[model samples]
Target: MTGWTTANILSTLFGAALFPFMIAVAWGKMVEVFGAAGGWVAGFWIVGVSWLLNHGLGLHHQAGDVWIDMAMAAFVGLFVQSTLAGGKPGKAVPALISGVLGGLLGGLILSIMA
Candidate 1:
């Protein structure tokens, strides 16, 4: 233990919580814009973003990391694809694509950070 302090623990908690918060915020916005279809699009966007954050942070093999990654991946792969395929292109499609791209970018960011 490297003398973990309150700041360190709180930082960790906040960092971890941010992922879900982002998903909720983005997803809700998407839903508002595109309804169920947008929700689907937002789902993928969340995954891509989450993946990037998780991998970028490169958190050690913690249970929380596992949960976040799994949740994000599932939404991106399943919901995003389905949503885009089901409906015409709305704002959601771009958002979803951006999310995945962002995740990739996040990987690069992590390389620099780590």
Candidate 2:
């Protein structure tokens, strides 16, 4: 058995498509649990959990590609939200963390839907 199976492929696509919402949902949970600091790593947490799920399910992703995409999702999701809210690129950890919280929230929502 391997991730190349059609089932795995479809599941991957499904997960990928709903990632935005997942971030949202996850972020809210993270904030509630870890407070503002949780945001710093919430995005990474989602990517880590999601990747683990994929691998556990036997999905095959090529060399770092999955990680790269996941990281991008985490950063971009948060970045956009923060930019809109503050109209600037935050340099401090709090700023980054807050942004990630937003992404986490999105991820959580996606997970619920899925």
Candidate 3:
């Protein structure tokens, strides 16, 4: 909270929102695959994918130690994934809202930790 730079703020928002945003995108698929346990499975899949991307795509987002990846609220879209997959333009509101919230809250949490 003392040294909150624009980079930190932006990074937290991006990192935290990344998981939920992805969840929203993949939620429908997860549900389709695991039936009742898709949410949990998706969460794990998210981390695994992030790790792979971090290595494959070089997503190095660990500034010192306060790296943000809050998947708890991923269900916020519940996510944009379904909307995207469903091809419903209007339903994208929830997905967008969730992403915004995810970014804000994630930034706040990271700021506090920092």
Estimate the overall C-alpha local distance difference test score of candidate 1. Answer: 0.62
**Predicted structure with the largest TM-score when compared to the true one:** 1
Residues 1-114, model 2: lDDT tens digits: 343667656765565544555676787789889988787688677666766665545343434343435445445666666576675664656876876898799878977996
- Name the best candidate (by lDDT): 2
Tens digit per residue, CA lDDT, model 3, 39-103: 78876777678656543454434455654334433544444555556667675679778978988
Give the clash total for candidate 2: 22
lDDT of each: 0.62, 0.63, 0.62
The worst-scoring run of ten residues by lDDT in candidate 2 lies at 58-67
For residues 1-114, what per-residue lDDT tens digits would candidate 1 score against the true structure? 455666656554554565656765577788988999988887687766665655565431343423345355445444555465585447567877998899889878977996
Better of 1 and 2 by lDDT: 2
Quote model 2's TM-score.
0.39
Q: What alpha-carbon RMSD in Å does predicted model 3 have with respect to the real structure? A: 8.4
Candidate 3 global TM-score: 0.40
TM-score of each prediction: 0.41, 0.39, 0.40
List, in order, the clash count of every candidate structure: 1, 22, 4
Give the Cα error of residue 77 in candidate 3, in Å: 14
* Candidate 1 deviation (Cα RMSD): 11.0
